[model samples]
Target: MPNIKSAIKRVKVNAKANVANSQAKSAMRTTVKKAENAIAANAENVQELVQSAHKALDKAASKGLIHKNAAARKKSRLAKKA
Candidate 1:
């Protein structure tokens, strides 16, 4: 609970941003899981899955939702699996 009005507003803004960030992170994770599942299933759509995963990771990194190195690491691992 923020005592100051400005602090209360800031908290509200932060809560909104937190929800948005969480959604983005969840999307990234879902995309990565899809890619990994495709790889594991030996699906013909592995390429598409990999591409989607890469794009999602890049977007997350660009948005500052994830670290650049972390994104690169995820891309590298996915590429290797693909």
Candidate 2:
């Protein structure tokens, strides 16, 4: 319960950003998991899935949802797996 108008606005903005960040992070994780599973199964679409995962990681990192180094490491590991 923010008493000041500014504080109230800040709370609303923060809540919106939180939801957006959560969705982005969730999508990134899902992409990575799909790639990992495909790699484990030796699926033919492994390359596509891994590529999408890399793209998702890059997007997340660029958006500051994740650290750039973390994104790079994940991408490297995913590539190694594929």
| lDDT, candidates in the order shown | 0.97, 0.97
Worst 10 residues of 1 by lDDT: 73-82
RMSD from true fold, candidate 1: 0.7
Model 2 misplacement above 4 A? none
Encode model 1's per-residue lDDT on 11-57: one tens digit a residue: 99999999999999999999999999999999999999899999999
Clashing pairs in 1: none
For all predicted structures, in order, the TM-scores are 0.96, 0.98
Q: Candidate 2, residues 1-82: lDDT per residue as tens digits?
A: 9899999999999999999999999999999999999999999999899999999999999999999999999999999989
What is candidate 1's CA lDDT for residue 45?
90
